[model samples]
Target: MVKVLQQATEVDYGFRPSYRKVWMAKQKAIAQIYGDWEESYAELPRWMLRVQLTMAGTVTVLKTSPIKLGDQVDESTMYFHRLFWTFSPSIEAFRHCKPLVSIDGTHSYGKYGGTLLLAIAQDGNSNILPIAFALVEGENAESWSFFLSNLQSHVTPQVGILVISDRHNGIKAAHEAPENGWLPPRAFRAFCIRHVAANFSLSFKGKDARRMLVNAAYAKTEAEFYYWFDIMRTENPAMCDLANRMEYDKWTQHQNSGRQFGHMTTNISECVNSVLKGTRNLLVTSLVKSTYERLAELFVVRRQMAEAQMGIGAGSLRSTRQTGTEHPASVAYNGSHRRP
Candidate 1:
């Protein structure tokens, strides 16, 4: 197992293969050359600990349980309840990215079923920058508060930071609670437009209503917002009422109070969740290791791409594709300073 892991890591430092892929590779190698060998998924936690210990300083782990009896240390009574990890480099890189972060949670299908919560940021080039990850017992107020408190302490401590998420009650409560320290004066919260649209669809049935609601949320000016919102009001007053009940400053682009940075949704965090879909069924430790390795590989690849782009002068034509319609070099002036 150690040899295979080492070989995999050598091939790609990220080395994130699904458990099924690993199992198949092992089966094939055994049939081809080595004698019969047996392995079970139960051993993955031990192997993951070994890897974490090997890379001790690079990986940070925090574990907690409800059965803390103060030095009594009952082995059977104590079990893994929550785990949070962040790689050294990821934490450092987050300092350079935007203060805007989107957080979300997804369920993990590993042997110990739990919820995986992630806090992700966006780089200047619009790439997903992972900040921290946590595996909690459930998606409740306590879990979210714990995750966000740790994230703030470890990754971001700047004031006026913006956080985006869906309308989950737990998230809402955590950010609003004074003790959580996520309220304004330090951090602000924004709602995802997608979740708003989903709620609108539930209350109002037609496609046009959905379109109108989206238009209002995406409007860049107050006049444009009213124009779209009035249409929705006329079509279905109840939908408008539901929307008005929500703090317009949180979901509407025009009323975001300059915190959202033009982002109206939590799609960035959702995209990261989708990228790790394959690792959902792995053991807890393997899941954490895979996330670290994958993020490291992404950082390396993106940095190389940025360097290659930098080699081409910034003032070159490659950067002017979005200038639209009139190219300064293409306009030819006649003797009268006018085009024929």
Candidate 2:
């Protein structure tokens, strides 16, 4: 029965059922298969490690590390401090996406508490592309530094690359620190507008103020930004002063040094977090597996959708040309065609 359910779930979701659900189904099958047997939750960590190890062996360019001491090589020194993983496919896919990447940390509710740090990018079609994932002890300066250091090495931020995230002190310090800061000289950092809006709402009370703040952030030009900003300041000088204290380049689109590609918030990362909510309570390994499987399915589905769209677009272009509605040269072919 458990096997049947697993098959059904994989067919529908491209992955297996959650461990708790599988365990419950196994409980009913135990009497018939193994005669009153049960599995302990404590064994889940080891089981998950085994699965990850197997995956690492099979998947080329797959990286995985279990928690252990940096100095010693003994059982006493071994501990689960963090877990990190990324695959070649994700890294390669990021190269074709926008130069912006959003980083965020979500708390994991597994028996052994930890934080899941993710680095996500946006593709040409504005789809969320998962770049890297790490399970850390917590969201502190040290943990964030470690995660960013690894990410810096992995992704290697280029000139004009944009990093969008919330105003977490750990993240702020990690990127701004002189010695090991992740921000390259050419790259820029921006704050999520939604987070900025929420903070503003807490300090200043009024729907109009909130609307003006958002409008200011989304302004496409300096004149437009100032236009909305003046309204906020005129309505409430104190609130405007507070908002001004935050860096202009970090919140406003017009002031950003790097190309944001029209993204002003870390909502892309947040969307990925929402999808993993159900797996957050699972063991470390299971959570990782769920992320990996779900991402694989997402990539497959989105790629097919994009190809289908391209096919339709090509067909429509051909039909238009045959009907003499527009000449092929007038359709703008890579700067080759020009208007009369």
Clashes of 2: 0
Q: Looking at candidate 2, what is the lDDT of residue 56?
A: 48
Query: Of the candidates shown, which would achieve the greatest TM-score relative to the real structure?
Result: 1
Per-residue lDDT tens digits of candidate 2, residues 73-97?
Answer: 4554334566556665677777888
- For residues 1-340, write the lDDT of model 1, one tens digit per residue: 5356556766887666666666666546543442232232234346556756776534444564545587776666545666767766777878778889999999986544689999999877687888889889889998898888878777778888899999898888788878767888899888889988888788778888888988999999999999998887787788778888988888898988778888989999989999998777565655776897898799799878867665553434344555653455543331111233
Question: What lDDT does the true structure give each of the candidates?
Answer: 0.76, 0.74
Q: What 10-residue stretch in candidate 1 is worst by lDDT? A: 331-340
Per-candidate clashes, comma-separated: 0, 0
> Could you report the Cα RMSD, in angstroms, for every candidate shown?
10.5, 8.4
Q: How high is each candidate's TM-score?
A: 0.74, 0.72
